[model samples]
Target: MLFLKPPGVYAPQDDTSLLTTALHEEPLAPGARVLDLCTGTGALALAAARRGARVTAVDTSRLAVLTCRLNARLAGARVRALRGDLLGAVPDERFDLVLSNPPYVPSPHPQLPRRGRARAWEAGRDGRALLDRICSEVADRLRPGGVVLIVQSAFSGVAPTLDALVRTGLDAQVADRRYVPFGPRLRERAAWLRTQGLVAAGVEKEELVVIRGEAAL
Candidate 1:
């Protein structure tokens, strides 16, 4: 699971591990087309490629895209790493499976960061800025009977995510859950989150959920 993570590129952590586990648990057919959105270090992308899936990873950060490509080359895995906003690089392409570990951490900032490492994790007040958009658009990219696995913090509201996917005519539900200690980012915002009622006082852990959405045949 170790990969080259440049200074500015996001290093895979707990959430990444959780999503990677889910990726392994899912049934993946050989040669299945897979798309990894907000691919970060492309850890999940590499995993899929190892499973014989045709993987394409997308990230807004140039560092991340380069890191993914180099990692894939070193691992001898074939992966197409592209630099672009989520789904923007392959608007006309459809996939048999899609994976995303997007930003779902609520932030005091109202707007998403246009530059820097913050772009990998800051997703506005509700943390749904990117999540909502992905839910709305991912269904379109999914081939019939395709599935998408998305990992996010429960603080971002799981119900809304399921509802959003259902509205898009996909069956969505929580596929996996884990409780982990807050990372530095969440720990720094603990007090603010408490004030916003997103976190309780003295609570040092957050729940991460992997939501699965499946398109109908």
Candidate 2:
């Protein structure tokens, strides 16, 4: 599928691919409702739509929303693209599956960016800004037996995510993990990560993990 990403919109990358793989593993019945938070290029949403699921993709960036819509159109996939903060725009809706690849890179900045390309990857100091939000609120938007697939770097606290979901009465675990060399963002933050003890000395690779959380039946 052809995706047109304007400047400032995040292009699909390893995290996106990993999330898509996990999405495919789910049992998506025909017409199952799927929600892609921080949808970016809408790759996962389009993939779900192609599987005969009804998909809705949400992003905080307008450019991202437009890019997702264009990509969905190009792929001949039906997806509702909305521009808003994660899970905030669809408060009344519940879905069978929820997918997210929200910003998980630790940023030098203490707060998330209000705009610009940094918003695509910068997630405050610990990179848990958005991840925590998802863990806290996603269960509420999931129907009984619904599942959520989320991808994040190991630098972020994977166990915390699991604990958060468990506390919310969902079964959560790491469904997939891949070791990838540092991307440009991580490479640039190597020094800070070392200072923060997020990375070991001279470590150049990080693990990307796809976490699956299922709402109680």
TM-score of each: 0.98, 0.98
Local accuracy of candidate 1 as per-residue lDDT tens digits, 1-217: 4469888788888989999999999888889999999998889999999999999999999999999999999899999999988988898999999999998999999999999999989999999999999999999999999999999999999999999999999999899999999999999999999999999889999999999999999
What does candidate 2's lDDT look like per residue over 1-217, in tens digits?
4568777888888898888889888998999999999988888899899999999999999989999999999998899999988999898899999999999998888977898989899998999999999999999999999999999998988999999999998999999999999999999889999999999998999899999999988
Model 1, CA-based lDDT: 0.94
* Candidate 2 wrong stretches, greater than 4 Å: none
- Pairs with steric clashes in candidate 2: none
Q: At residue 204, give the lDDT of candidate 1.
A: 94
lDDT of 2 at 150: 94
lDDT at residue 3 of model 2 (Cα atoms): 65
Model 2 TM-score? Answer: 0.98
